[model samples]
Target: MAARPGYRVAVPRTQPEQQAPPVQRLRVRYAKRGRLRFTSHRDFSRAFERAIFRARLPMAYSSGFNPHPRISYAGAAPTGSASEAEYLEIGLAQVLDPAEVHRMLDESLPDGLDVLEVVESPGGSLADLLQASRWRITLPGAGDLNGLVEAFLAAETVTVERMTKKGLREFDARAAVLSLEAQTSGDVTVLDVVIEHVVPAVRPDDVLTALASVGEFPTGIVPLLTRVAQGPLERATGTVRDPLTPAS
Candidate 1:
């Protein structure tokens, strides 16, 4: 072969690097009902992962060969009870409209799971800002709910002895209780309470301990417990999807 004359290869110009879209973190509020209520925290997390897979949610993953989805749960309610307020934060691969995400999640969920709200979670994780939670509990009987609240309030310190995994522990029920009030409509009496879910966390059994101290909770029947809201951070603190309203 004839030797070709040496020629310099043309250098290609580098185009400006494109930036990836910003990842979005969102808070999703969902409900647990029916047989699903009995699911433990781990079970719920697993279920959510499967449902997300089924829903084909645009979940963002950590950078690794075996990447995990970026999801964080606020906390879990006790097993075998229904909850109206439960929340989790998930990072999305792409920023989608909150309304659209909400609708999609609702459709993707199995029976007894309801998507209540989807909003932008800014600045803090649910674990950080969740100082307290509100619950409305209804005992089995029409028995004196008002008296129970009054008794619960009058006590200087209500103590509940619980057996944790570590050992027997005593918690001040009064300290956990922020507000306790009673309301009656038709046949049932409702005990609406806002309690401090302190660091170690208070269980529904702890509340029952307080109630049982005042008076017996309707035996054999689990009380109806519904979590209404959670946060130390207010609507003013972050970018909430809805219009701000004064905390009640």
Candidate 2:
């Protein structure tokens, strides 16, 4: 091989690869409630890494010039919405009690973002185990939405459009909805829905769009959506089981 005149070849640098697996791994379920629900995913991730450091956790890091802690997150609820079953997994360089980890991290994180449960991973991927999500959406002053929900469910397919980073796209929102029901929570009317995991994930807002298309949804009304649970779906019951709970 010969070098071209006035041209220099650049060799790509390779960083050392991580050699050992973490001594301990833990899966955690947490909640984003109240004002903290407005926190974006990036903001939460940065805060979490800081919490790990502040808690003096022996977190496992990747091997490189810029090593990042080995923390894996499952599908996160959209911003501006609360969640009770957000999930993440962390790798640790040392073994520790799962309960103790939960207690310490819960104390370290800011209020409104609480750690609900922690379990030692039994050697499996958390992402693969999660199959669906259940949500509760409250619409204040919107009146009864039972007719709209019934119409949306009766249809074979209810398409909705939303502006995404890749431009406006259309998808069938009805297909992902496993169950939809209207219930009263004190003074507010709530829509309890269970949605199966699918590509281009359907959000609570998309479901609302479908409802608006089918029936009357009062204008000037804002919806409060909260992800109630996310984990393995029970097809018979159309509900998601807690990942932290052992299968019966």
Instruction: Note the Cα lDDT for every prediction shown.
Output: 0.73, 0.90
**Clash-forming residue pairs, model 2:** none
Q: Give the TM-score of candidate 1.
A: 0.78
- After TM-score superposition, the amount by which residue 73's alpha carbon in candidate 1 deviates from its true location, in angstroms, is 1.0
Candidate 1 lDDT, 89-116, residue by residue in tens = 8888888998988888888777787888
Error of 1 at 171 (Å): 1.3
- What does the lDDT come to for candidate 1? 0.73
Candidate 1's error at 213, in angstroms? 1.9
Per-residue lDDT value at 20 in model 1 = 34
In model 1, the Cα lDDT at residue 22 comes to 36
Steric overlap count per candidate:
0, 0
**Candidate 2 ranges beyond 4 A from true positions:** 1-19, 185-187
Model 2 TM-score (2 dp):
0.92
Cα RMSD (Å) per model?
9.3, 2.8
